[model samples]
Target: MPRFQYRAADANHRIVKGQIEALHETDLVTQLDRLGLTLVRASVVTKHKRAVKSLTQQELINFLFQMEMLMRAGVPILTALGDMRDTAASTEAQHLSAGLYERIQSGETLAAAMDKYPGIFSEVVVNLVSSGEVTGNLPEVLRELVRALKWQHEIAAQTKKMLMYPAFAMTVIGIVVVFMMMYVVPQLTTFLLSMEQGVPIQTRALIWVSDLFLKYWWALIALPPLLIAGVVALAQANPGVRHFLHFLVLRIPLFGEVLKKIILARLTDTFALMYGTGIPVLDGLGHCRKVSGNLVIQDAIGRVIERIASGTSISSSFAAERLFPVLVIRMLQVGESSGALDESLKNVSYFYTREINESIGKAQAMIQPIITVAMGLILGWIMFAVLSPIYDSLSKMKT
Candidate 1:
């Protein structure tokens, strides 16, 4: 289908300019007519494929929030979508709304409409919406999705805050080290050697490293990215490599623990939504396997699914896997026993969410000092190595 940018006239005779995808000019005209507008002119912008970008998390949140509020106000789904299509700020948002409106108008359910835009909607969101459609809880599901997307954005921002300063600080430190090794150290080494004095061991080591930097600066700069890209490619192509790497990643110290909590928080939150919306335990678990983005967690969820399929209760299945924290397992047991599994999973999600926030805060607070000390150590070493041999030469000359 071709997308057309059209100039149209609404009922009040106001000119509207927007883009829509359709088969041809006729289809574009029809789409405009359906939107209660008359098409004045439309030129085909692109043929066959949608070139729109995907929505960011914040955009997705706002979109869902609007939809939820409109639905709650008793607006029909199509009308709500049409309103979105007309008022959308970004071309991508307009395209999303137009694409969904077109699909829904063609007799597909809202979930089915959203499924076509996999770039915009995750399987989790699609699954929740589908469940909501069946259970007549679409508004509630949309509201939950809005909340979840917001939480995800918050967590992501916090994680970035924790890592960004250190990354930048290290990059600066790296440049300084390279400059010192390649230029400063070489000049001082020549002076020390020219004086015909014995050079210190540390200065000799520094000169050797400096020589390597001067000789292979390009290689030093390029090798890290090439190796990283190669490892990523290998991981993508080989499941075993990916699994092993993911397993190791989960073992990495403080960073690993925070990552694990992030995954588990999403998992428990999704389960809470699934359970609250009347999705089946086994089905929800099946969908949640990839939520963690870690093979180990996915494998664990897979086993939990199998246990549930084999007649184990959900909480027991989680416990048997030995994967969840004691608090989570206890909450699951309580919720399962009390016939309020969703509430229990929500508590787990909240616990992990709070933990992740605090961890990020603490990690950020510690990163500044650690980076400072690391840079200080590097500078201290360079200063000591440069001055020691030169000072020794002066003292011996006086003697």
Candidate 2:
């Protein structure tokens, strides 16, 4: 189906315009007619779509919440979709709702249409919706999705906030340092040289640095992007290098700890969601392996899957891999014993969430002092270099 952008007037004669998807222009016109709207103009919207809007975590959560309410109130899928569509304020949400409506109208399942936008909806979401439709527990599953997405979004927001200040500080400091070396220090050094006296060692060193910077300023400007590109190219060309880079990322001091915890939380959250959908443990782990972005974890999952295939339990396999923290392994063991693995995975998610939050706070606190000290040291060195010659000239005159 293709999406069409259209302008129309409703019963109140108010103009409405938005993107809608359908099989053909006739199908869209029929949809508009059903809505009691007269289409004034419509055209197929086409672009080389490089990406499709996967239902956002927030939008999915909202959809779940609304669907739960509507389903509990005895509303059908089509009716619920329409209600949600008309009520959606954001263009993206409205567009998705419209797409969903058209999909249902065309006799497709919700999950089937959602499959078209993998970026918007994850595999876990598709599976959950499929299960909900099968077990007639769509309302309950939607409620769970709302809870899970909210938790994930909150953690993400905290992580971003924790990083923002240090990143900004580093950028500002870098700009100031570059400016001093390239412009300010060079101009001051010229005046000092004109004094017809030997410059101090500090001044001499500064002059040399300024000259070098002036000569290779373009190199300094181009180095960062070029280095980034080179690294990216190598990573893409070699799986070993890519894995090595990911491993290095996980080992970086403050930021690395937070990142690891965040990834763990996401993984555990997904596992818990799949488990809740009545998926078999081994099958859920298989899907999780496909979705895990970290190669190290994916390798560990490969090993774990092999063990599970050979009749070892989830906890035993996880323990053998040693990929999970002790607490996570213990939780899995308990869940296996109690047959409440979903709840256990949820616990693991919460534990990592707290860890990520604390790690972020600790990282933020450490980064501030470290960045401030670094900036101060760089500025102090430049100042000493620029002022040393002036001080030397003044001393000779006084003598």
- Candidate 2 lDDT, tens digit per residue, 1-399? 467899999999999998876556876787788889889899999732223355666776787788789988899988888777767856677777777777778889888978776878878778888888888887888878778778878887888898799889989998887788888987787688898787778778878888888999899889999999999999999999999998898898888778877877887787888788887777788778877788877888889989999999988998998777888899999999998888999899888877887888788889989998999898898888777777878888999
Measured on C-alpha atoms, candidate 1 has an lDDT of: 0.87
Q: Residue 55 lDDT in model 2?
A: 60
Weakest lDDT window of 10 consecutive positions for candidate 1? 21-30
Which one wins on TM-score?
1
Worst 10 residues of 2 by lDDT: 47-56
Number of colliding residue pairs in each model = 0, 3
- The sequence of per-residue lDDT tens digits that candidate 1 reaches over residues 335-396 is 98998888888999999989998887787777788889999999998898888887887788
- Taken over the whole model, the C-alpha lDDT of each candidate is 0.87, 0.82
